[model samples]
Target: MFLNHSREVLRLLTSLQADLLILEENELLFFNYFFSFLSSVLGLSITIWIWMLNKKQNRRKDRIYKQLSGTNALLIIWVILMIISRFGSILPIVLFGTPGYDNHLNLYEEYWILFVLIPIVVFMQSWFTVRLVYQAGRWIFSTFLLCMLTAFVLQLTTTVSQEKLNLAYHQRFERDYNYIDQEIRIAKEKYGIDYSEQTVEILKKQVTESSVKQVESVKKAFFGDRPVTLDTIILQKIIIRNYKEGGRYYYKRNAIENWRYALPIDILKQLSYFDQNAKETKELLEVLKEMIDLVNTPEIHWQEYQNFTETERRRSLGARYNIPDPLIEQLKKVQTRLLEDDLYSDFFKNLQAIKDRE
Candidate 1:
């Protein structure tokens, strides 16, 4: 019977492990639901077993009854002290804004003394006396507490482990994002193009305001006494706006439409269109090559956008901008030619294989 019970317990525990294995990263909602249900079932089972064990012991009527002795009082005192010590340790953690269950194992470590004394308390108590019901109740409550605490500890471990992995992933993402930003800046500098969010906002204000003085004030606040030509301002506005909207149009296919609004494409087109003279065409080609490099970058994963269907690309954030179809077609042709000659041919092909579900 003991062997069968042990096997049953082991099976339940194994099932719980399997449930935990299926839980994905940062998914606390489902994790809590499963953990709570399993622990409750386990706790109730143990509580029932303990009640049955106490009932069997109740059959022994020869068991002596005694008054609350010094040893009992001393044991109770020790238990109280153990609880106080545990709470004392936890208070600082709570005050510092850490959740009580964040480090569930710490509860065990802090109150190990209390757990050691529980069995002793059970053995010393008189099972035949009126205290039998109270003792059973305490046992049931303790069993439930241990079961839930174990579940909480396991949940914490899984969550913390996933958080660490995500931290590393985000760190790598930021590094790649910064690298792309730097490349975009260099390309803009090469073409004598200057653009930023502040600049765009400033230009918008200037366009809306009727007062020339207010516009000059805004320009001075941004540029700080530097002379800026109206042509330069218009070009900067175009470059900044196109880079952002165009990037969303050409790339960011895998991302949600609303979220893709935050992502701006590289300033490749702005540099290409800055000076279309024959003398600058060679330099323009270099800028185009840089754009191609940005697109093919394995780290940025821009292929996801390239793999997007014509409908998806056309339905981008900049779809309303109505970028010239001729210019768009020419850029695509140049990009295709560049990819054919590039060493990362395999990478580009892999991108093509990533068909958009949309």
Candidate 2:
């Protein structure tokens, strides 16, 4: 029965080690799993040897005492090491909040309980096995009760940790989506573009997808397989510094610009349905693309005037940059077609207003 139980434990441990090895890309987890497995195997071997010594009849008490003395000495040294490991694992999280520079230590903290549990379980099993030789029923009941209690504690801890993790994930998702929605709202106010139902749906879908990807990226940085690279490390430091200095608004502004650029392209493409001349439409699309790029450039800033109209500001900036006459003529053609469509006339009008402000 003892041998069968040992075989089962070995099998389970082997399976777990194999599963962990498959995640070897995560070097920190790999090493933690390796060391924990090594310690468990060592502990189990020592227990088996002690059990064998107990079974010997010749010089039984003396032999058992000598063997147990050595085991106790080893256990004391292991306990000291475990304490140090546990302390090292927790100190970084208390200081940094998350896995920052000392990811190895953080990973150890994640599994340190497992490391502590393995040796303890082994020692308890050894004690119970020896006791069973004399008080079989009592030792058996005690071992079963201890196992149940240990399992219950472990399950409770896991459940609470999982609930906390889920809550955090949802909060992050909501926060990111809110940021994206704010940019969209600003765009709507500036452009006066009464988005059609279809267009609104498209924008929502795209924004949701983008937000999910962004959140996933953050999750990966926190808890995924981290590869060490100089560029990545530098980027992480920059991001952390930015957050500390309240420069996170920079990301919000960047998102605003990205959506600002994307919205016009999509709206313009949809409005192309109003123009039937395929050739002119193609040319108009090309010119619109060029105009969007030109207007977005830093050099295209509108000069303030006491009573400058939107068209006047555009022409002045165009001349200042020495924009070609042909490009200007093509843009005027686009403006005329856009204004002819009652549904999107306000879109082009507000678009010009944005250019004037820029």
Candidate 3:
């Protein structure tokens, strides 16, 4: 049990280390941009389709499907399609996307309903109302209840909550924004940048600054215009340093960092999107493939290489041919330094940048 705990701790630390080295500011900025870019066009298309798709009458094909009256042929297929559509959104998002906070938008994909289940839903409801068909109501209601029970049970283990199976679902609701209002409590905390309309409006109107006595420390470490502190490896700053240290060989680091934050290229820059049809969407997928490539590349283990070459003093850098590599000793240092360079430290540092930008 102790060993299992130790292993989990080691894994989490390793992941944190990896995330620190690789997650770049630009890529995050880019991702936001890409998300926006895709959203605008996709949203417009969805709106248009929804507007056009809406009809007072049941769709012809949906009517056909509803007309078939058999437990085997009708109920089976309708149920199968419903199950597929439910999983298409609820299953995948609940299963994988939730924990990572990935692609919640997929949980809202139009095809899940636009082409299939929604029309079926409309058909079933309409057929019963128009023709007063109440014969299959027993089976339909039973099947629906059974499916809901099954879904609720399965969701317990899914990435999405077995209980709260909604994407736009707020964990809790607050009607008032007042920090001390009777109805509103700040609670312990909230999420990443509150870009909700009200918050964005406020941010758009103000800038906050902190005048630090040891401002020079931050400047040296992460800011440019002077030498970088060991921790402050900015892209433009690093590009200049890369040329000085090992030349273009280190350029890949820039690419990797940039790619990580790039999110989506045109989106990152917030470029013009004159084209967003099927072809453009296809091209976007290809760009995503390239981004995945960059995400997979491992961080360079310069220390490992140095440790390997300790026997050959001439080949190694950093404090001569290097001292004996002690795993226990280095791990202790990692734990100690983690206290110094904690998550809040970096999170606030970039947070300041976002504030500055506003």
Candidate 4:
């Protein structure tokens, strides 16, 4: 009888856990939709380029081409649908821009005009390129030939370069995401962010504000006060660290990967856009400094010392005077405040109102 009651309790716990996960999973969907959209963009771009390059209109080849016509249609349709899906995916956020499941998109809208233009351009380019390919030896329209050749080369280079860039981009994206995830695990386990319900607007503002100021500081240091040569050296170091450290600390990657963007966090909080007196500001400046150090080093990851908590637990509160007891907890409380803010709710409510009006 006791075992049966225990089983029921465990089952209830599981269900409750799943329900909570489902609730929190909304933020994660943006990454999914974006990654899918990027994949489609890259895939369609490559397909269109290939079709444009290979097309020919000779009679015998046409007959042979008819057999492969289904393949071409399939490819074209795939590209078109993917494009449409991506466009459809982004519309909710940019237009009405709701949050959560009904939102069905991201709060931070990422736009690409190429999504609409590519399909139309693809078909047109395919038609023209087919004619050009067949007339390579003959004199086709001079402008048509020039345009065709240029499109051909441009398409080839763009597809190749985009793939390489996306490759680097995704690698860094995943790396930084994992890095943030690692930190979150620390935040939850060692600190107490996971337990807090106070996560909301002020928290978001803090992170966003911090990041923007950090970037702005770097920009000013490089372009405003420091010489171009000095900035170039810093940029070179950043690039080298990106390559060497697998980008554990880079900004475009690490900074963006943060679940809570420091820029918007700072913005919402109305923190100083720039800290004029970094030397004097102790509490706030220290946090900013850690972030800046992370950005600059581009290699050093914030790692919680293994057995840190365990070691802490072994001692009494005042048993260890050297280590600060509240520092770890203080850091975690700050993190929690960032996560559970009411800002998104207010933002979403306003957006939905506008959407309803429309």
**Which candidate has the highest lDDT of all?**
2
Q: Measured by TM-score, how close is model 4 to the native structure?
A: 0.21
Global lDDT of model 4: 0.33
Q: For residues 180-288, what per-residue lDDT tens digits would candidate 4 score against the true structure? A: 4454455456534452333221111111333334334433343332232322223222222221111123334223332121232332232233343322122222333
The C-alpha stretches of model 1 lying farther than 4 A from their native spots are 1-136, 140-160, 171-175, 180-358
TM-score of candidate 3 to 2 decimals:
0.21
Query: CA lDDT of each candidate?
Result: 0.36, 0.39, 0.28, 0.33
What lDDT tens digits, residue by residue, belong to model 2 across residues 1-358? 2222332233233222121001123443344443443344344445445555554545667567546644654564476457645544344234322212212334444775765565565545455434423544675466445555554443333221123333443343343335435544643575443434543332222123332333234324423233322222222222221111110223332232222111233325533443544433433343344454454433334344535533334335533443333434444565677678775465456554214323
Off by over 4 Å in 2: 1-125, 128-137, 150-267, 273-343, 351-358
For residue 81, what is the lDDT in candidate 3?
46
lDDT: which is higher, 2 or 4?
2
TM-score for each candidate, following the candidate numbering: 0.25, 0.30, 0.21, 0.21
Tell me how far the alpha carbon of residue 221 in candidate 1 is from the true structure, in angstroms, after superposition.
23
- Report per-prediction Cα RMSD to one decimal: 17.4, 17.3, 22.0, 22.3
> Which model is ahead, 2 or 3, in terms of TM-score?
2
Worst lDDT 10-window in candidate 2:
239-248
- Work out candidate 4's RMSD over C-alphas: 22.3
Positional deviation of 305 in candidate 1, in angstroms? 17
What overall lDDT, based on C-alpha atoms, would model 2 receive against the true structure?
Answer: 0.39
Model 1 Cα lDDT, one tens digit per residue, 262-282 = 111222333333343432333
Task: Give Cα distance to truth, residue 330, candidate 2, Å.
Answer: 14
